[model samples]
Target: MEQLAEKSKKREFVKHPGLGETGIFHTKADGDPLPDSQLLTFALAGNQNCGKTTLFNQLTGSNQRVGNFPGVTVDRKDGVIKGHANTLVTDLPGIYSMSPYSNEELVTRQFLLQDKPKGIINIVDATNIERNLYLTIQLMELNIPMVLALNMMDEVRENGGSIHINEMENRLGIPVVPIAASKNEGIQELVDHAIHVAKNQERPGRMDFCDPDHDNGAVHRCLHAIIHLIEDHAKRAQIPLRFAASKVAEGDEEILKALNLNQNELELLGHIIQQMEDERGLDHGAAIADMRFKFIKEICDATVVKPKESKEYARSVAIDNVLTGKYTAIPAFVGIMSLVFWLTFGVIGTWLADGLDLGITWLSELVDLGLTAYGINPVVHSLIIDGIFAGVGSVLSFLPIIVTLFFFLSILEDSGYMARVAFVMDKLLRKIGLSGRSIVPMLIGFGCSVPGVMASRTLPSERDRKMTILLTPFMSCSAKLPIYALFTAAFFPRYGALVMIGLYFTGIVTGVVFALLLKGTMFKGEPVPFVMELPNYRMPGFKNVWQLLWDKAKDFITRAFTVIFVATIIIWFLQYFDPRLNAVSDSQDSLLALVSGIIAPIFVPLGFGDWRISTALITGFMAKESVVSTLTVLLGGSTASLSTMFTPFSAIVFLVFTLLYTPCVAAIASVRRELGGKWAVGVAVMQCVIAWVVALFVNLLGIMMGWV
Candidate 1:
C-alpha cells in the first residue's frame, strides 16, 4: 500500500519546462488537466434500472459530480471509487444498445470511442440476464478490458434462480462478479476485479458473439465481407475491427463517416447490406439484432438455471395487475403521490420543520442580544440579523421538508414504483404530444428543474425533448417547497398537505393545458412510442434511502449558503440604498422598491399587487427558493405580518401563479442549451403569460364562489 501511494505521488508531479514543479498540465483549449497514468478510468455501462446506478453509488459513494458530455445535455457522472486510490469511474447514461439510436446510446458510444477509457464495467440484471446480455455483446465488441457485474444476484437467488458465475465468466472470457448493489454486497470484489483488469490491460478474448464466417445466412456472409473490407481502416482509426465491421454492415452513417470510406467503398457497403437484406428477408438492423440475441440465448442456456415460477416476478405481476390496470392506474398514482405529500408536509416533515424553525428563531434572538450588547453598528446589525439571517435562515428551516420529500421519492424510485408510474401515464402523456418517457424528466423536475430540464435529453425526438423541457418547470421543484411551506404554515396550516397536493396538481394541469395548446399550433407532432423495462420490485435499502436524504439535505444547505446567501446580500443592498447610494429610512423609497413598483400594477388583477410581493417574484427568477427568503427579509421574518398580506383566495391565486410561472435562470439556461435561445425566451414569456391569465381566472372564480 505504501509503495502504491508513493507511485501515485510520483505520478501526480509532472515536470513542465516553462512551469517548474507544477503538479498539473493544462490543455490549451479548455485548460482542463488530464488524469495521470496512476489514475485509471473505467466506464460503467448498463441498461436502465438494472441496478447500475446503485452499483455506481456504492462504488463512488459521495465522490461524484454530475457533468455533461461534450456537445450534449445528457448527464455524464464521474466519480472516484471508494478504497481505490487514483482510480476514477464514470457512470455512463443508462442505455440498452450502442447503436446510436438515441442520444444516450450515442453519447456512451462516442465517449468509449473518443475518450478510450481503460476498462468497462458492464452491469447486467441477473434476474433478466438474457435481455440484458444483448448490450453485453455489443460492449464486448468494443475490445476494451471489461468486467461483467451480474448485479441483483441476491434477488435472482431469492427467486429460485441461479447463475454459474465461473462458467459464465469462462464462456464470456471476462471476469464475472455476482453482486447485490443495493445491499453493498460483493461491491469490493467487483471494484478489485475491475482495477486488475484495467491495470493489466486485459481485453476480451471472445469478441465474436456470432461467427462471421459461418454459413448461417447472407447476413453472416455480408458481415464477414464487411469485416475484411474495413479491417485496415478500423485499425488505422483505432476502432475495434469487429465493432466497426458490424456497424458498417448495419449502415450506421456516423461510423461510415468516421471511417472516411471512399465513394466506391460506400457503394460496395450498400450493395452488401442490400444483398443481405434481400437474401435473408430481414433488414440490416433487424438481422444484426437477431444474430446478437441468438448468441445471448446460447450463453444463457449454458450457464443460467431458471425456476418455472419466481416469487418476486409473481409478486410484481400481482401488484401490476392493479397498479397498471386501465381503471386503477391513474387513481393509484394520484393516491400514492398524495400519501407522499401527506408524509412530507402534514406529518413528519411539518413537525421536523417546526422544530427547526423554532431552533433558528432562538439562535437568531441569541445572536441579536449578543450584537446589541457588543454595541455593534445598527446598519451592520440589520444586515446580519434581518438581511442574511432572515433571508437564508427562512430557506434553511424548510430543509426537513426538502429532505423528507426526496427521501420518499428516492424510495419510490428504488422500489421500482416510479417506473410503473411512467408506464401508467403513457396513455395520458401521449395525448399531450409526449411519450410516457417524458414523465421521467417531469418526476425529476419535482426534485429540481435544472436536472429535470437536462433529463429531457433522454427523449429520442427533438420536438418531444424541447416540449418536455418547456413543460418541466411547471412540475414544482423542491426549491419552491420553502415558498409553499411558508405560506401554508402562515395561512393554511390545517390543510398543509392538501394545499401542497393542490399546488402540484395545479402545476400538472397547467402544463397539460399548455401542452395541448402548443401541440395544436406551434410544435405539432405525434409523440414517439415509449419503451422501457420495469425491474422487479424490491425492498429499498435503508442505507440507500439515507444516502439520498443526506444528498438532498447537503444540496439544500449548500444552495442556502451560496446562491441564497449571495442573493440575499444583493437584495439587502438594493433595499437599503437609494439611487444616489444614500441610506434609506424607508425601504419603499429604496432602489428595490422603485424597480419592483414598475411591474407591481401588472399583478393587480392576479391579487398580489404589493411592491414587496412583486420584488419577491422578480427575485424568484434568480431561484425559486429566493421567493421565500426575499419575502422573509421584507416581512421582518414575522409569519403574522406575512399572513396579513393575503387572504385564502389571494393566497391560492398567488400559489397558482408561482406554480405555473417561469422557472429559474439556471433552468432557462438548461433549456437554451437543450433547445435553443429562441425557445428558451419563448418558454419564459409563454409561462409568464399563462401564469397571469390562470391566476386572474382563479381569483375571479374565488370571488364568484364567495370564498374571498
Candidate 2:
C-alpha cells in the first residue's frame, strides 16, 4: 500500500510540458539536484494560421497540454521540446499585434510583460512576410531575446519567391531560421538558435524602424520622445521602454493608465501626439501604422525577391474564383458539408459502428453467461452486465462516428478550405449580426463546446464574444453524435445521412434565428468587419490527420471510462433502488423515475414524456454522451426495445430536443469561466426554454401534417 501511494505520487509529479514546466528533472532519478539557471522558458507567438502551432506540436509531440491564461479564456498551450532537456516552450494565443485590442492580444502581451519568458520565437509566414513582419517589429521593440522563425518557407519557395536569409538576419539584427513547420523541416535548427539566444540573454540589437532623422520622421521622433518621458515608469513597471513609447504614441488609454502619469504629464504627452499627427497629416494610429508599413516595405525590398507566379498560386486563385465567388460559394460549402455528413453517417462511420455494436453485444452476452455459470450474485451480475456493460458499451459503439467526423473536419481545416468557408459565410453572417470570425468558434464547437466557448476570446468586442458563446452550443458537438446515431439507427435507418444533415442544419438555423433576435434586442450592435487570411491550400499530411483522429478518439474514450462510466453507475443505482436503498424490481418504483416524473411532463408537449426519456436528459446534463448510455441501460440495450418507447415522428422530435437543449456541465462551466455566472446561467435557462419551444413546434407541425 505504501508502494502504491508512492507510485501515485510519482505519476502526479510527471512534468506537464503543456503547462509550461521546464522539465520534471530538477532532481535526478537518484535525487541529486540541478541548478535553476539550467532551465529555460521560451514563448512562441505569431498571427493566426502562421504554422506556429504546427511548429509547437513538432517540437513537443505528445508532451504538450492545453491550459488557460490566468484570468482569460484564451488557451495557453505549453510543451517541452523533445531532446532539449532544460527547455520549456509556451505557445501564446495567436495575435496580430501585442496591443491589448482583444483578449487574445492582451493575454499574449501580458505574458511577455509580466511572466517575462526567457526568449521569444516570433513565427512569420514566409509567403506573407510584409504583414507578418508588422507583428515581428512590435516584438522586437519589447526588447526580448527573439529569433525570426520564417515558417512556411517551402510555400514561399514553391510560389517562386525567395528570401535572402543572411540579409534578413543582418537587417533584423536577430537570427533568422527558415522552417516549413508542417513538414518538420529546419525545426531543430530553429530550436537550437532559440535556445542559444535564451541561454546568452541575447536581445535584438536594432529596434528602430524608421530613423528619427528620415524625411518623414514625425512618428519616429514622437516615439523616441515618449520613450524618454516614460523611461522611468516603464523601468519601474518592468515593461520595455520602446513598447511603452509606441503604445503611448498610438494614444492607448490602457498604457496611459498603467503609466499613472500626472495631469501635466498627460497634457504634455497629448500635445506631443497631436503635434506629431498634425505634422504627419494623419491620426496617431494611422501615423504609427504607416511607419511600421514603411519599415516593412524597406525590409521586404532588401531581403525578399518575388519571381513569376507559380502553378500552385495560379491554381489556388482559379479555385477561389468559384469557391469564394458571390453566387457559388454557399452552395459549394453546403454540398461539401453534406457530403462530409453522408460519409460519416450513411457509409463509413455507420458500417464501423455496426461492427462495434455487435462486438459489444457479444461481449455482454459472454459476460452474462460466465457470471451465471459461476453463480455470481444476481444483483452483482446485473450491475456488471446490465448496468456497466450496457451503459458504457452503448456510448463506445459510436466512437467510429465521432472519429470519422473529426477526421474529415481536420482535413478541411488543414487543407485551408475551412478558412474559405469563413470568408464565404462572412457576408451572410453579417446579416445575422456575427462576423466570419464567429464561425471559427462555431466550427470548433462541432468537435467540442469547451474550446468553442473559449475560442470566443479572439473576438475584439465583448458583445461579440458573449453572443458567440451563447450560439456556440447550438453547433451540436461530437459528444452528441452518439445520441443522433442511436436514434437515426432506430427510427430512420434508410435515410440516416439525410436525417443527420437535417439535424445539423436545424441546429445552425436555430442558432441563426436566435442570433438575429439577440442582435435586434439585448445585444444590439453590428458585427465588426471581418478580416482574415486565406492560406494557400495544400494536401494535409497523413500523420497530422491521424494525430487529430487519435486525439478525438482518446478524448471520447477517456470520457466514456471516467465521467460517463461514473454517471452510469450512479444512474443505474438510482434506477434500481427506492428512496430507502432497497432493490426495486420495477424502475417506476425507483427513486430515479419518481424524481424524473416531475420534469417528464414538461417534455410531453415535445412528444417524449416518459420517465426514462426524462432521466436520460437529466444525465445528459453531466455529459451529452451519457444520454445514449442512460437510454441503453434503461431500455435494455436494444434498438427494438427503444423503438417501443417512441413512434418515428416522436423520435425525431426527441432528437430535436436533445440537439437544441443546454450543453453539458463542462461547457457550462467554460461559459461561466469566460462570461461570468450570470451569463452562464442565462445561457442554460435560455437554451432549455428555446429547446422546449422549438421541439413543441416541431411536434405540433408534424402532427398537423399527419406524419405521426
Candidate 3:
C-alpha cells in the first residue's frame, strides 16, 4: 500500500486510453494545494448508454436523489462524494447529441452553458466510440475544459477494436482515460485528474476545429454565407450562433422557429443550401455528421487494439439475450417484479414491522409505567404515550419495511435490469398511450410522491412529463402500503399477496387508462419515440447496496420525525379541538365527524361511508404515509389485529380509495410548479374525481354482488 501510494505521488499522468491508463490520481494524501473547503463540481456528459451514470456513481458514490429541473420534468441529480470532501458531482440526463432535439439534451446543454462547472467529465463507451464520439465532438465544440473518460474498455478489447490513447490525445488535444466503471478500475486516477484539472494544475487546450476540404462546393459557401447572415442579424443572441447558423443551413425546423427567421430569409437560406448541395453532391447534415465520425474513427484506429476472445464480452452477450430477448424476458420481468413486491411487503417487510411494533409497544408500556408510578395526570399520560408515541412512532416504525424495499430496488437498478424492463414493456405501454419508461417515476411514486414526481424529470418530452406527473399519484405509495397491508391481513389472510397485487395493478391500469384519455384531449400529444441505453450489468456491490438502503431508510426516518411529526401534531389539534368534541360530545358527535359526515353521503354509492375513511383520504394529501397513521389514530389501537377492525367490503373500498386518491401537497406543488397553475389545477381536480368514482364503483359492485 505504501509503495502504491509512493508510485502515485511521483507520476504526473494524464488520462491515456491506449495504455489502459485513464489518469494518474491521488487516492490519499489530501489537503495539498487545492483547498479542502472549495466544492469541485464534475459534470458527466456522454451519449445514451455510455456508462456515464455508472461511472458517476462509482466516483462520487450513490447517495443521491432523483429530482426534476424547475419548470421541467427532466431528472436533475446532485450528490456529494462520500470519501472525497469538497467534490460534488451531477449526472446529467443522457443525450444522443448536444443538438437539443429533446429535453434531456437541452437541459444538459443549458447546464453546461450556464452553470459553467469547474470541469466537464465526458464519458465515452470505448466499445462504441464511433456513435459516442458524435456527442464528444459536440462537447469539444462547447469549449468547456474537459477530461475524456473512456469507459467500458473491456467491451472494446473483445470486439476487435483498439484505441491508442496517446495518439488520440495528441490528435484531439485533450487528456483521455480508459476505464471499466462496472469493474471499478481506474476510478481513483479519474478523480485525481479531475481535481488536478479543476485546480488548474494542468490545462486543456482549445479544440482544433477542422475545416475539411469540400473543394469549391456551393452548399458549403452558401451555408457559411447564411451563417454569417444570422451572425450579422442577431449579434446580441450570444447563442452558439455558428451552430445555430449550421442547423438553419440544414433546415432544422425547431431551430428556425426558435431563431424566428421568417419565410423570405428561410427561402434565401434554402436556396443557398440547394446551391451548396448541387456543388458538393451531398446532403449537408449527413456530410457534417459523416465528417465527425471519420475523425473519431481515425483517432480510434491509431490507438486501441482488440482481442479475439474475452470472458467479459461473452458474459455480457449471454446476459443481454436472457434479459432482453422477447419470449423469456417478459416472463422474467413479471416474475422479478412479483418477487420484489412479495419480499418487500409480505415476508421481509411484515416481519420487520412486527418486530418494531413489539419494541414500540414495550417502549410505550415503559413510559406508561413511569407515568403511573409518578401519579402523573391520566390525560397528559394518555396524550404522550398513546396519541403522540403510538400514533406517530408506530407509523414511523415502518422504516425497516420501506428501507428493505428500496434496497431491492437499488440492486435492480445497479444491475441494469430496470432499463430492460422498460425495453420489454414499451410495446404494451404504447397501447395505453404511455411509454414503458413511465414505470420508473410511477414505481418511485410508491415510495414517496415528492421524489416520484421529481423523477419525471428524466422524461425527454414536455407532454410526457406532464402526463407522468399527473398520473403518478394514482400508485399506492408506501403510506398506502400499510393501509393495504392492514386490511389484507385482516380480511384475506390466505390471499393477502394476491389482494395486494390487485390493488397495485388497479392503480397501474387506472393510470394507463387515464393517460390514454388525457392525451386524447387536454395535453394532447403523440407518444414520443422511446430510446434508452441499457448499460452492461454487473454483480451487485454489497457496499453500494448497503449505502442505497441506508440512504432510503434515512429519508423515511427523517420525514417521519420531521414532516410526519409536525403533521401529526396538527392532526391532533384538529381532532381534539373540534367544537363538538371539546363540548363533551360523544365520539360520533365531534365537529370533524360532522364535517366528514357531510362528505360521507357522496361516498355512500361506494358502500364504505363511515366518514373515518373519508378523513383518511383527505389527510393523504399531506403525505400518503399519513393515511395509515390517521387510520391507526381513529381505530385507537394496533393494526396488527385488523381482522376485527374492518369488514371485507370496507377493506376493498379502503384499498381502492388509497390507490386512486390525489397526491400529497408536496407532489401537487411540484406539478403546479412544473406544469404551471392552470394544468396543476386540472390535474388535481381530475385525480380527485376519478379516485372518488373508481372507489365508489368498486364498493358498489362488491356490495351488489355480495362478494364483499
Candidate 4:
C-alpha cells in the first residue's frame, strides 16, 4: 500500500491532446495502421420462440440478458462469443420476415443492410422447418455470409422427424448446423462452423429462386429485367442486387425510395412488373410471394421429413381448449392473475417479507445499542438508527414481494401463456383503438414502465404505439408495490390480497378508460390489424425463469442501495434541519416539512393533507420505492407507527392515488425516448390530473356514504 501511494505521488499532469501535444499514452511502433474499430459481428436472426436467445446465451455465457416475451426483444443486444474474444454476436429482435410492417422486421432488416456485419446466424426451429425456412429464404436474399442454426433438433427427433442435413445445406447454399440450444447440444460444432463461414466471407451461392418453367418464364423474365435495369442503382446504394431486385418486385417502398429510381426508370420497372402479374395471374406482391413459396416448397420436399404432431403439441391444443376457448379465456386470465397477486401479497411474499422485516428490526436494535454504547454524536446516532435503517431497511423487506410477483409473471411469459392472453384480449382491445400487441407492453408494465414503454415499439402502428406509451405508466409497476405492501400490511392485513388485486384491477381499469378517451380524442383511427402466432405451450425452462428472477432481484437490491440509499440521506438531511440549516426539535419544523406543507393542500380533496405523505409523494418522482422509505423515516421507525398516521378510508384513497399516478423519473425519460418531450410531459401532467380527480371522487363518495 505504501509503495503504491508513493508511486502515485510521482504522477504529474500531462498536456491535453486537443492542444496538438500528445498525452502520456502508448504509441504505435513503426507505421502499422490502427486496427478497425468495428468488431467482427454475426447477426443472430430468427423467428420468435425459436431458441435464438438461448443460443445467444450459450454462446455468450454470462454476457446476455433476456426480456419476457418471445416476439418483444425491443432492444439490440451484443456480446462476445465465450471463447472468441475478437468476434461479437448481435441478438437482434425476433423477426419473421424482412418486410417493414413491424419494428422487429424493420430493425433486423436495417441492421443487416446498414450495419454491415461480417455474417449472419439464422436460427430456425427444426420441428417447424417449413414455416421457419420462409424467414430463412428472406435472410438468404440479403446475400450476407450466413449459417443456419437448426435449433430444437432434439425435439424434432423426439417427435419422430428428421432432416437431410447435407441436402438442406446444398439446397439452401449455406452451412446448416443442427443445434439444441436449450440442451447445449451441438453448440461447439455450431460455433466452429459459424466462425469458419464468417471468416471465409462466404455468401449464399444460390440466388435463382425463379422457376422459369412453372411461371411461364414470366416472373423470371421480370426479375431479371429489373435486376439489369437497376444494377447500377443497387451498386450506388450499396444494396445487394438480388435483394434489391426482389424487394423492388414486391413493391417495397423503403427500398424503392433508397434506390431513387428516376421517373423513366420507374415507368419501365412498373411495365415489367405489370406484364409479369398479368402472365402469372396474380398481383405483383402476390406473384412475388408465390415465387418464394414455390421455391420453399421445393426445398422442403427435398430436405424435410415432416413430423407427426408431437404429444407436446397435442397437449398444447387440449390446454388451449380450456385456456383459450372463447368463453373460458377471459375468466381464466382473471382467475390466474388474481391467484398470482394472492400468492405474492396474501401468502408467499407476505410471509417472506414478515420474516425479513423481523430480521431487519433485530439488526437495527443491535446497531442502535452499539452506537449508543460508543457515545456517538447524538444527531449522527439518530441518523444511523432512524435515517438509514428506518428508511432503506423498511423498503428492503418488500424485495421478495416484487420478485415473487415477477416470478409468476415470468412463468406465464415463458410458458407461452401470455401470448394467449394477447390473443384473447385482441377483440376487446380493438374496440378501444389499440391492438392485441398493445397488451404485451401493458403486461410488461407491471414489472417496470420503462421496459413497457420500450416494448411499445413492437406495436405495428404509430397511433397504437403512442396510445400504449401513454397508458403503460398506469399499470402499477412493481416499484410501486413497496408502497402498496407497506400500506396494506399496516391497514388491511386480513384482506391485503383483496386490496392488492383491487389495486391491479384499478390500474387496468384506469388504463382502459384512458385508452378509450384517447381513441375518441387524439387517436380516432382503428388499431392496425393484430397478427400473432401463439407458440405451443411447454414447460418453462428452469434456467430461463431463474435467470430472469435473479436479474429482477439483483436490480431491485441495486436500486435500494444506490438510488434509494442516496435519496434517504438527502431526505434525512432535509427533514432534520430547518431553513437556516439549524437542527430542529421537531420534524414538522424542518425544511422538507415547511416546503411540503405548501404543496399539501393539493391532496386535501383526496383526504391525505399531511405534509409528510405529500413529501414522500414528491420524492416518489425520483423512484416509487422512495415513497415507503421516506414515509418510514418521516412517520417513525416501525410499521405500527405508520398505521397510526392514516385512517382506513384515507389509506384506501392514498392507494388509489398512487396506483393511478405517473411513474418515476426513469420511466418518464423512457417515454420521452420512445415518443418525444411533449408526449412525455403531457403523459406526466395528464396522469397526475387524472389521479387527483379520481382520488377526490373516491373521498367524496366515501364521506357521502358515511364510510369515512
Candidate 5:
C-alpha cells in the first residue's frame, strides 16, 4: 500500500523541458536544484577593415545596429543566437588593444572587465594575422575564456597563408574557429563551439608565454612578472582572479582605478616598470606584447592547412587593390553615388511614382462611382472624393517611389560597399570635424530626418552625436525631390535632371559647412579618430533586401497616414477659416495667410515675401512634405505649374531655407530626448535663425542682380 501511494505521487511530478534545467539539456527531475548553465556573453572584437562586424552580424543575424565609427559602440551590444538560446553575443567597438588608447578601446576594455561577459569572441583577420594577433594576445591575458575566430578565411587562403586551427587550439589552450563571415560560412559551427566553451562543455587552456632561452628572454620574463603581480592583486580585489590578474599585468588603467591602489603601491609599480624598461631597452608593456605575437606565430605555423588554390581568395585581393587604390577610390565612390541618386530620382523613382499615381487615380474613380450609385448629395460627394481622396490620397500616391529608393539603398548598405564609401570620404569629412561614419546618418537623412536624427544615437560622444543629429535635416529628403522636380521641369525643362542633382548636392555642402562652423565655435571638441571595419564584399541575400525594403516602405506609408494625415486636416481648416474673407479673392484671407503675413516682414530682404511662400515655411515644422501641401493650398493649385522654382537665385534661396529650417516635430522630440530640455529649445531657435539669415542673403543677391 505504501509503494502504490509513492508511485501514484511520483506520476504527477513529470518534469517540463524549458523550466526543467539551466543548460542546453535537461539534467534533473522536477523540484531539483537549478543547473549551473549560464547565458554566455561574448564580445566580437577586432580591428578596422578586418570584417569584425560581418562576423558579428553573421553570428547574430540582423539583430545589430550600424553605429558611428571609432567608439560609436559606447555601450555593449547583446544579441541572442538562434540555435544557442543560452548564448548572447556582444559586438564591441573594434579596437587594436584593451589598453585605453582611444575612446573605443576604453569601451571595449570596460565591458570585458567591468561588465564581465562570459567569454570574449576575438575576431582576427586571417589575411592580416600578424597584426590582428597582437590584439588576440592582449585578450588572452585578460584571463577570460576566449575563442579566436579567424574571420575572412578566404582572404587568408588567397594571400598564401594558412591557419592551423587544431595546432592553434592546442598551443593557446583555447578553441580557434576559421570562418568566412561575409559568405556566412562556418558561422553556425563557430557559435555552437563558442557556447560549448562558454558553458564549460569545453574549456580554454593557457596561452603559451614563449620559450625563455632565446634573445626574447626578457620579453618572457616581463610577461611572467606581470602575470604574478596580477594574480596577487586579484586575490585582494576578490574579482575573477584570472581576468583581474591579466588586466593588472597588462596595465589596464580602469582596473587600477577599480582596485583603488594606494599611493605607495602605485609608486612602487611605476618604479618597477621604469626599471624594466631601462634595463631591457624596451617598455615592459610593449615587451610582453611582442612575446605574445611570437608565441602566436609559432602555433599558427604548426596547425593550419590550405588547399593548392582558392578562387574566392584571389577575387577579394584583386578587388581590394582597385577599391582602395589612391587615385581610383574617390572617383569610383563619387561615380557610384551619383549613379544611384540619378537612377533613384530620374529613372526608377519617376516610373514608380507614375505607376502608383495611376493606381491611386483608379481607386479614386471607384470611390466616386460607389458614391454616385448611392445617390449621395453633392457636398457629401465632394467631401468623400475631393477632400479625402483627392487631397489625402494624392499625398499617399507616391508609395512606389519611396519603396524603390529604399530598396536601392538597402542593397548598397547590405553589400558592404557602404563602408567603402565612408572610407573613401573620410579624408574630406575629417576636415569638417566629422568622421566618415557621419555619412550613414546623412544617407538615412535623405529618406527622412526623423530616422536620421535617431541614427545619431550610435555616435560615441554626446557632442558629435548631437551635432550630427542637428544638421541631418539639411539633407534633401525624398519628399523634397518632387518639389525640385516640379520647379526644374517648369523653369528649366532641358536641365531638370541636372538641376535636381545640384539641389541635392547643395544640401550636402551646406551640411558640411555648417558642421565646420559649429565645431570651430559652439561645439569644440577633440577630433575623434576614424577606425572602421570594412566587411568583405558579399552578395546580399535577396530575402534580406526585400525585407528591408518592406520595412522602410511600410514606415513611410504609416507616417503618411498618421502624422501627414492629421496635418492635412489641420491645414484644411486653416485654409477654410478666413475671418477677413480675403483668401477667396487673393487666397491669403485664411488663418494660415494671417500667420504668414505676420512673419512676412522678417523675410522682406529675400524679395519673395508673399504669404504663400511664408505659410509653406510655417507648416514645414510639422513635416517637410507639408511644405508642398501648404504651398499648393496657398497658390490654389499644384507647384508643377509654378515658373519661379527654377531661377538660379530663387532656387538657391529655396534650397538654403529648406536645408536650415526647424526639423519636423518628431525630430525635435528626439533631440529633446537625447539632449534634454534646455538644449532642445536651443537647437530649435538656432536652426531657425540660421535658415532665415542664409535664405535672406541669397534672396537679396538675386533681387539686386535682377535675376528673381
Candidate 6:
C-alpha cells in the first residue's frame, strides 16, 4: 500500500484538462494564470436519488430543485460554497456511470475529461452502496482529487448496517466521510477533505483494481499490455492512462476516437481484449464489469456490514403493490391528479384566489376614486388601474393555485412516487416511441415547458428527445391556469375542478395522439430501453417541498412582473389607441382590434371570431399569463364581462385551443437551443395548426350532438 502511494505521488496529472501538469490552474482556457485561479471548483456527483442534491444544498445553500426522480438536474448548475466565495461547487446531472450511453452520462464524461474540476465530491447512497460504488470505481480512474461522501449513513445505521470509513478510504485510496446529507451531518468534514486534497493535488493512490493473480492473470495481463500500448496515445489525447485504457478495453467509440489510435495498434489491442474475454468466459464489456464488481465485493466484505431491509423499503413495496400494480397504477395516477386538481381549483386554491381577487378589486376601486377626485389624466389612470393592476394583478391571484398544485406534485416527487410513475409509464411511452424517462420532462412540462424542454436532454435517443419536446407544450402548463380559471369562473363555476382535470387529460391525450403520428412519420424507431432505480419511499421533507414551492412562486412572480407586465402594457396601449395615436372609447375600433381582425376570420370556424379574443390569444405567445391579463384589461377588468364574449360551448372550444396551442416564447427558445431553429419553427407551426384543427373539430362535434 505504501509503495502504491509512492507511485501515485510520483505521477502528477494536470489539475485542469488541457493545461500544464503543474497543480496551479489558470483563469482562461489559454492557460494564463490570473488571481481568479484562487477559486477552487469541485464536482458534485452521484447516482440519481442518492441525496447528491441534498448535499449540494447543504454545501452551497442554494435551492436547485432536488427531486427523487432522475433527470431533475438535467444540466450543470454551479454555486459558491456557503461562507467560501473562493470555492465553487458544480452539481452535475445524476448519472449511473461514466459510460457515454445516455446524454447525461456523456455530458458528465465530457465535462470531467475536457473541463476538469479540481476535485470530485462523490456522494454514494450508503444503504445501496454496491450500486453506487460502481460509479465510484469509474470515477477513481480519472486520477483527480476526490472524497467519497458516504451519504444516508443515518439510514444505514438505523437499519443495522455500518461502514468502516477509514478501511474503505484506505482501500479506495481516497478520503471517505460518512454523512447524512438530508440532516446536514458530517458535511463540513467532507468539504474540508475535498478542499485539502484539491489544494494539495492528492490523486488516487490505487489505479489497479484488478489483481494479476485473479482469473489466471488473463484480465490483469490484458489491461497492462493495452495500457502500455496506448500510453503515448493517452498522453497525446491528454487523458489519464487508467481511464483511457479501461474505456478502450470496453470498446467505447468516443474514447477510441479521442485516442486516435492507428490501425495496427487498434488490431493489437483488440486481440489482447479478445484473448482476455476468452479466458474470462465473458464478453469484453462484461469481463471488465465483472472484474470491477469482484473488487467491490471484496472491499465490501472486509469493511461493510450489510443491513436488513428497512421499514422504508417495506412501506415502498406495500405502496408499490397499488401505485405500480398492473391494473391499478394508471387509475391511481388519474385519481391522485384528479384529487390535486379538486383541491386546487374547487376548494383551497380557488378560495384563496377569490379572497385575493376581492382585495385587489377593492384596492383598484380606491385608486380609481382617488384618480377621479384628483382629476388625473384618463390615459394615465387607465395604465395604472386598467393596465398594470388589471393585467398583472389578474394573473397574480392565480399564484396560490399554481403553488398549491406544485406542492402536491413535490410531495409525490419527494416521497419517491414519481419514480414509480415513470416505471409504470414505460410500456405506454414505448408505444409512442418514447421511454419512461420521457415522463420526467413531460411531468415538468405541467409546471413549465422550458425546463420540460431542457429535461429532454437527459434522454439518450434523439428521436425521443424531439418527440418529448414536441409533446410537452400539450401538457397544460400552470401558466395557462389563469385562462382556465377565468373561463371556468365565467362559464362553468360549479364544474371548475372537473373542467380543469378534463383539460389536462385532453392535453395529454392529444399529445399522445400526435406523438403516435410523429413516430410513424418523422421518427420511425422504438424508444431506447428504460432503466431506473426505484428509491424507497419516505415522508416528504419540509425543506424540499418548500424549496420547490418557492422556486415555482418565484419564477411565476418574476414572469408576471417582467414578460407579462410588458405584454399587458403594450396590449392595453394598442387596445385603447387607434393607428393615428388617438385614444378610442370603443376598443373594437382601436388599433389592436383592427390588427387582430385579420386573424379573427381564421378562427371563425372554431367559434371564437371576436377580434378581442383573437388579440388575447395572439398576445399569449409572449406569455401565456398574458392571455388572462390582456382579456381582463380589454374586457374592462370584470370576470362577468367574459360571459358575453363566448357561449359555454364556444368557451370550451377556446379552452381546448389554449390548452393545445404553442407554448410561450421561453419554451420555444429552449426547444430551439436543443433541436435548432428549424425544429423550433416546426414545433410552433405544428402546435398552432393542431390546436386550430382540434378546436374546430370540437366545435363541429358539439353542433352535431346538439350540444352547441
TM-score of each model, paired residue for residue: 0.89, 0.90, 0.84, 0.93, 0.80, 0.94
Which lDDT tens digits does candidate 6 get at residues 586-607? 9888999889999999999998
**Global Cα lDDT for candidate 4:** 0.84
Evaluate residue 64 in candidate 5 and report its C-alpha lDDT on the 0 to 100 scale: 43
Residue-level lDDT of model 5, residues 195-291, one tens digit each, is: 5555542323453355677454654454445445554565576555444534555577767776666787778667656665666676666655665
**Which 10-residue window in model 3 sums to the lowest lDDT?**
65-74
lDDT of each: 0.81, 0.82, 0.68, 0.84, 0.65, 0.87
Best by lDDT: 6
Q: How well does candidate 2 match the true structure in TM-score terms? A: 0.90
What total of clashing residue pairs does each candidate reach? 0, 2, 18, 0, 5, 0
Backbone clashes in candidate 3 total: 18
Tens-digit per-residue lDDT, 1-708, candidate 4: 223212212322221132111111111122233244535689999998788888999999853445435446789988899988889999999988888878898998889999989889999988887788888888877777777889988988988888888677666667778889988997887777666556655566565677779868898888888888887898899998778988999999999999999999999999999999899899999998888889989998998898899988999999999999989999999899999989999999999999999999999999999999999998899788889999999989998898888899888888889989989999999888887888998888888999889989888788988999998899989899999999898889999889988888888888899889889999999889887788888788888889889988998999999899888888899999999999988999999999999999999888889999898999899999999899988876766776566899999999999988878999999999988899889889998999999899889999999999
Q: Which residue pairs overlap in candidate 4's backbone?
A: none
Better of 2 and 3 by lDDT: 2
The residue pairs that clash in candidate 6, if any, are: none
- List, residue by residue over 216-255, the lDDT tens digit for candidate 1: 5676678767876776788788888778988887778888
Best candidate per TM-score, number? 6
TM-score of 4: 0.93
* TM-score computed on alpha carbons, candidate 5: 0.80
Regions more than 4 Å wrong, model 6? 1-6, 9-37
- lDDT, residue 62, model 3: 67
Ranking, lDDT, top scorer first:
6, 4, 2, 1, 3, 5
